[model samples]
Target: MAATAEKVKRGRKFAQVLEGARQVFLRDGYEGANVDEIAREAGVSKATLYNYFPDKRLLFLEVAKAECQRQADEAVEFDDGSAPPDRVLFAAGRRIADFVVSDFGQGVFRICVAESDRFPEIGQEFYRSGPGLVRRRLADYLREAVARGDLEIDDIDLAADQFAELCKADIQTRRVFRLPGCRSGETLDRIVRGAVEMFMARYGVKKGQTKA
Candidate 1:
């Protein structure tokens, strides 16, 4: 139908706008990015840009959501319970830690923190779309693991939160502050392995053991 075609076109245009907005935001930060530049970069007219996003804050929120969703889609994949708990946790933890320290991730986080006071909503949206989303997904995985007798978690949600925090450990803070010394793969792997070991120490169940 004509309406369906129009909707498809609009969705494509929206995706284009989001990609352009991401680039602008990453380069200029939220306070410095300009709508005109975003519109130009997206190859859309100013009117079209405005029509898609009513205000800069909403546009930025959408961009953050898209970025977070993309990361989740690519990195967080333990839903089907296909892999062993150790392997799943390590993969998920490493992915999260790497993303939190990546340039794009750091930029988005800095923008949220810098704009938090004036634009608290931006911070809230970022948390909801990023870390919060990841935590919830991890909690679901933990719950499933518990049901399978692989983990003996009494509080899956809290365990998920703890595991996430442990994975980040010192790396996230150092990266956020732009501290010296690059994190090599070995260092990251070591951190993730330690986190998994610590988690297993508390929640992991040996074979033939019942859930705690």
Candidate 2:
């Protein structure tokens, strides 16, 4: 168990280094970023960074994983048990929207798009973190709703991803591009409300009733 515990600690440290590398790379770009800088940012030694990651490319991938975990942790929620499905989804949507609209979110997304041609691995990792996490959590929620009889989903996972796409598509893209006049309190509210209505229209069913 000591070996296992040590491995876990090392893995966590590596993950932190990756996260630091990602932030620095996103802010400074690939050529400008350095492993030593990443180590300093992550509070690890240069030797430690190399102990976990042999190259900058691997560190970048790790960074993507860390970011994904953060977003996944933030966007997914436990059922309050009292609120309706739409309410729960809306709450989750709001959390996602808030993140997408932030400066750091935009920076990271920009890095993914800009660097995709040069670093396909990083691009894929970014996709896995952003869209991948969203889909997984949404699917899990939909499956739960199905079990609870709030929804009648034959394909819970796909339904969850689609639901998240519907909720986030506009805000996410616009925010990614830093579009002008693309958002306001009213806009976010409308987006959430519209997404909830659309989702319920498709998957929601009267309790205990099978799909028509």
Candidate 3:
């Protein structure tokens, strides 16, 4: 139908605008990026760009959400609750830590921090799309582990937040501050291992123990 074709065309244009906006935001930072450049880069008219995104903040929010979704989809893969808690948590932690410390992630984070005072909604959007989403997913996993008696969590949500914070440990601060050293895999592994150990120590149950 003509309506369906129009919708498909609009979807493609929307994707194109997002792709261009992402590059602009990454290259120029939120404060420096301009709608004109974004429209030009996306090969769409300024009117079209505005039609899709009313303002740069919304566009940036979309970009941030897309990036978070992509990372979550690619990194956080579990095997139907079959894997051991340590294995699953470690895998998720490592991926999250790595992504948080990556250049792209750092760039996006900096933009949110820098613009938060001027545009508080940007920070809220980033939180909802990024760390908030991750925390919820982790809590779901923890709840499942508790049901299976793999963990003895009193508050799965709190435990999930704590575990995620633990994974950051020394790494996130350094990355945020633009410290000199690189985040090697070994260092990330060590951090995740330590976090998992602490989490398990606190919440892990013995073979026959019930929720005590």
User: Residue by residue across 1-212, what tens digits does model 1's lDDT show?
Assistant: 11222222245588888889999998798889999999999999888888777778778767766676665565466747777899899998998888777888888788877878876765776676678888888999999988887888888889999999998889888987889653678878999999999999898887776555
Off by over 4 Å in 1: 1-17, 35-58, 68-72, 207-212
Give lDDT: candidate 1, residue 32: 93
What is the Cα root-mean-square deviation between model 1 and the actual structure? 4.9
Worst 10 residues of 2 by lDDT: 1-10
lDDT of 2 by residue, 118-149 (tens): 76766676566666776677777777777777
The predicted structure with the larger lDDT, 1 or 2, is 1
lDDT of 3 by residue, 77-151 (tens): 554688988899888898788877888778778887787787676567667667787888888888888888778
* Candidate 3 Cα outliers beyond 4 Å, as residue runs: 1-14, 35-77, 207-212
Q: What is the TM-score of each candidate against the true structure?
A: 0.77, 0.68, 0.77
Q: Which pairs clash in model 3? A: none
lDDT of 2: 0.72
Total clashes for model 2: 0
**Per-residue lDDT of 126 in model 1:** 65
